[model samples]
Target: MNAAPPRVLTVAGSDSGGGAGIQADLKSMLANGVHGMSVLTAITAQNSLGVQGAWELPEEQVVAQFRSVVDDIGVDAVKTGMLASASMVRVVASLLRTLPADVPVVIDPVAVSKHGDKLLGADAMDAVRSEIVPLATVLTPNLTELGPVAGVELRGVDDRELAAKILLDAGASWVLVKGGHDEGPLSVDVLHGPGVREEFSSPRVDNRHTHGTGCTLASAIASYLARGYDVPAAVGAAKDYISGAVAAGFALGGGIGPVDHAWQFRDISHPGHPGRSKQE
Candidate 1:
């Protein structure tokens, strides 16, 4: 009999666009050779353009979904995205508290969508900080989210590192401050915690179809960690995976599309790209 694949569970919102949230998370996990599972916390009426509306699942339902999966299928690692309300955040945090301490939890403090649509409400910010953020094994927050989660404005690379440190102090074992919104020819992401800091640099791929980069990255990190990579190693592998996905991104639909989660398996028929064919 064949061994079962590594199991990865995503607790996040639903993106109707199928580019981010639970969709993207599961796609990333599968692409990285893990069996993916999800617990939907909210549902968004979203598309390529922006989010039109969002409805969070009731706290009881959310908890039941989580328990059903974790109690039976057994998640090797868990990744969390948008929790639309304070109550939802509190509920999810409480559930996390019940999990085994060694289970890796990758938290992507999703605040806004790729099109700048706010996914998290202001009223829920405090709850996120008090309940969710501290439970993360690694907290992945972009620049816009850094201020609220880390309680400081990040203006430069130095500021980003400082903010990551502060987030780690807040409770996360490690922090990855994504600098995708920063102004530079290169995108710089800093991972810092436990008195160790590592910087990852990649030339910015000028693509507007970069919708699910954050979700993909955090999920990839969780997937890799579930496969037994250390935090730094997991972050490094995920960074490389996202960079390649970004570089190979393609446009879809009418608005901003998503990164190709399966870029590593894409066919390269161009004559000059002989060795770049998709993997089976």
Candidate 2:
């Protein structure tokens, strides 16, 4: 008899291009050995080039999807992305509160795409900071979101520390200030809160095919958390996983491409955790 895989749920939008949003989240979950499930909050008409259009699901639909998954299938961890509006954020946040307090919730505060298209509306940024962020077990946000989240520009190592403290004071137990936007030889991610202050740095891979790094990293962290790793351990493992994915990214359309979610299976030379075995 086969044992059940650790289950992770993604509540996000659908990227028709299959490179980001729900597609990337589920792909990262599977790549990290989790049984992936999804509750799509929006759908986009998009491709490798860019997003042409997007439509948010009605509140009723979003609620129904969330219920359909958690009411029956259940979940070990949940990761949220592309919540298009304040109301949508509130709905998802409320539903997440229903889950047991122990179930880790990874919030990827996705604002813009690599092609510079807005995924989360400007008005919605307020919702993310006030309504959505407090529910975060692990809040992940890139520099673009720092101004709205902390009312300060997140730059330099000093700014990273200030911005982190502001968000921690707001609500999230842990804040992962993503440094992907920083121009430097090293991309450093800071995990800060409650007796934790560690930076995970990896040599920056010079590639434009990084369309889904945010979603993939957040989902990987959730997957590792479901596999029984502590918060610090989970973030560290996720950073390594995303670095490998970024290095292996391949061109898809005429525009930015995607991180190779299956890079682990493709490159066996790199060391990875055996206990978090690849899903067949």
Candidate 3:
């Protein structure tokens, strides 16, 4: 019998729009050649415009789903997105504590959605900092999210490095400070941790369809790590993948759309290519 493929489990919310949250995570994982599983923490009545409503699952239900998956399928790596509530964050952190310490955990401290909708509540941020972020093998946070976790305003490249350092000090094994929200022609991300700091640079893809870039990037990192890449290598590969996805992003609704997680399978063109077909 053939061995099963690498299994990556995502503990996150659900996006009804088929764009972000569990939807994007699974898409990115499959696109990167991994089997995806999920423990839904919450569900959102969301669309391309914005999130109209959200309902977080009870802590007991979240725990049940997580235990069910890890007890059977056995995740090779785990990626966590929006925990939604303080109680949910606590539950997830406790579950992580019980898991084998060697398992790679990618935490995307998802505070808000691409359309500026609040996903993680204000009270939950503290739970995420104390419980979740510290448990992460790699913590992926964009500029805005980093501000609260790192307690530093990232205004430039140097500030981004400082923000990474602060997160590492906060107990994350490694930190990827995303610069996609920063102002510049070059989108830079810095990966820093114990005795390691590396920078990844890509020309800013001038596209607005970036609804789920954070979830996609974290999922890609977890998938790559499940395939045996080290933290740095996995992050590098993930950066490349997300950069391509962002460049090929397309508009869906009235607001921001999603990144093309399956860019590898589609014959999409680079940002400036005029003759490229938008259809899959």
Candidate 2 global TM-score: 0.93
Query: Which 10 consecutive positions of candidate 3 have the poorest summed lDDT?
Result: 271-280
Native-referenced Cα lDDT, model 1: 0.88
Candidate 1 regions off by >4 Å? 155-157, 270-280
Candidate 3 local lDDT, 1-280, one digit each (tens)? 9888899999999999988999999999999989999999999999999999999998889999999999988989999998988888998999998888889999999999988999988898888888887899999998889977777776666777787777787789999888899877899998898898788999897799888999999999999999999999999999999998887788888888888887777644554232254442
Of 1 and 2, the candidate ranking higher by lDDT: 2
Write candidate 1's Cα lDDT for 1-280 as tens digits.
9999999999999998899999999999998889999999999998888999999898889989999998988988999999987888888899989888889999999999999989888888888877887899999998999888877876666776777777777788998888898887999998888978789999887788788999999999999999999999999999988988777767788988888887877667532222354431
Model 2, global lDDT: 0.89
Candidate 2 contains a number of clashing pairs equal to 0
Least well predicted 10-residue stretch by lDDT in candidate 1: 271-280
Could you tell me the lDDT of residue 112 within candidate 1? 90
lDDT (Cα) of model 3: 0.89
Cα lDDT tens digits for candidate 2, 1-280: 9998999999999999999999999999999999999999999998899999999999899899989989998999999999988889889988998999889999988888878888887788888888878888899988887767777875567887898898899899899988899988999998998988999999897778888999999999999999999899999999999998887788898999898898878645443322234432
Colliding pairs, model 3:
none
TM-score per candidate: 0.94, 0.93, 0.93
The clash numbers for all candidates, in the given order, read 0, 0, 0
Model 3 spans > 4 angstroms off: 153-158, 268-280
